[model samples]
Target: MEPGAETLYAYANRRRREITEGVNGGSGRIVPVTIAAGTFPFPIDATTRNAIASAATATTLAGGDAYTVPSWLLPTGRFITLDATAIVVVALAISVAFQAVFSAQAAAFAGIADGSVTTHEAVDAILGS
Candidate 1:
């Protein structure tokens, strides 16, 4: 038996409403996708898709904290490479300063115990050292 016109039209309208509601209600939800690093490999029309793809890489897009594209994929205007050497140098400097401070404190305490320096003098030396 054939379906009636009213039943068919109602079914189509219900399906349309279901699709529209699903799209609107799920806004701001995280959807997972994968893309390689360093290339605008995704279609331009879908921003969400591109963002998800870009976030898979360590290098973030320039002008924004959020990774919008792989560093390689971005135009020179759109992205900047992180300074790994600068980071390493700063880390080393911090480590050396910490070591120096601790060594000075230990030496000052030792000197105070050996009677080579007074307690008050040791405290001042530790602070300056």
Candidate 2:
């Protein structure tokens, strides 16, 4: 049989046991999902590159739904009329990474800007060398 592409997932954070007998309102448990294997990285293909180029302009043009760009990236769906791929790629590059925009930081400071890493080699979308 052909496995084709096997996605082996190992979940890191799991609540072994809930809050004991009489706990307060919220203990503040969070579901953390760290990709054990590589997943959707900053797409480097020609198509993705072109999309990002277009979005780069849109980002500035359609600024300040909240004034400042957030640190942890997630598409706001603010630019749905525009190209989705472009917006996502551009956003991932700019706001998702650890360092400033496109700094080639590695070793303790790896991010989407590190061209050396790829989906196959990376454990996470942004990783430290």
Candidate 3:
């Protein structure tokens, strides 16, 4: 039988978790966050996700203006010293990449529900797995 909506949604949730945890199929996606202090390895994990969301919100509220984003923490427990413009650029890119992957997963789930997708391979293709 074809996969049910519950099963497909579960798979999609697992894919999102995998992407956030940066493990299993989601390994090796390191974002090199460069700031005035230096470059740091930003893992695709919960903390980085929160940071991106916060930064994105700040950028939006600032209306694309430049200023100081003070004391942004790095993975190494060190803080980055950078102005708003540079961090906004990095945040925009990171958010876009994540949004694309998640949107693909959502599309896969929707396609499966609508009978447009019938195979595991098709779902994987849409989800980039």
Question: Which candidate leads in TM-score?
Answer: 3
State in Å the error of residue 33, model 3.
Answer: 7.2
RMSD of every candidate to native, in Å, equals 28.6, 16.6, 4.6
Q: For residues 48-122, what per-residue lDDT tens digits would candidate 1 score against the true structure? A: 334433443322233334323224222224542323332223234333443444465556555555655454433
lDDT, residue 47, candidate 1: 42
Superposed Cα deviation of residue 33, candidate 2 (Å): 13
lDDT of 2 by residue, 1-129 (tens): 311111211100011111111124332212122222212234232333445555655565666231222332222222223233444544455344323212322321232234333232342332222
Ten consecutive residues with minimal summed lDDT in candidate 1?
27-36
**lDDT per residue as tens, model 3, 55-118:** 7677767776655667766667777765666666667656666677778887988898898877
Residue 13 miss distance in model 1 (angstroms):
76
What TM-score do all the candidates reach, one by one? Answer: 0.35, 0.23, 0.61
lDDT of model number 2: 0.30
RMSD of 1: 28.6
Best model per lDDT? 3
Backbone clashes, each candidate: 4, 0, 0
What do the candidate models score in CA lDDT, each in turn?
Answer: 0.36, 0.30, 0.69
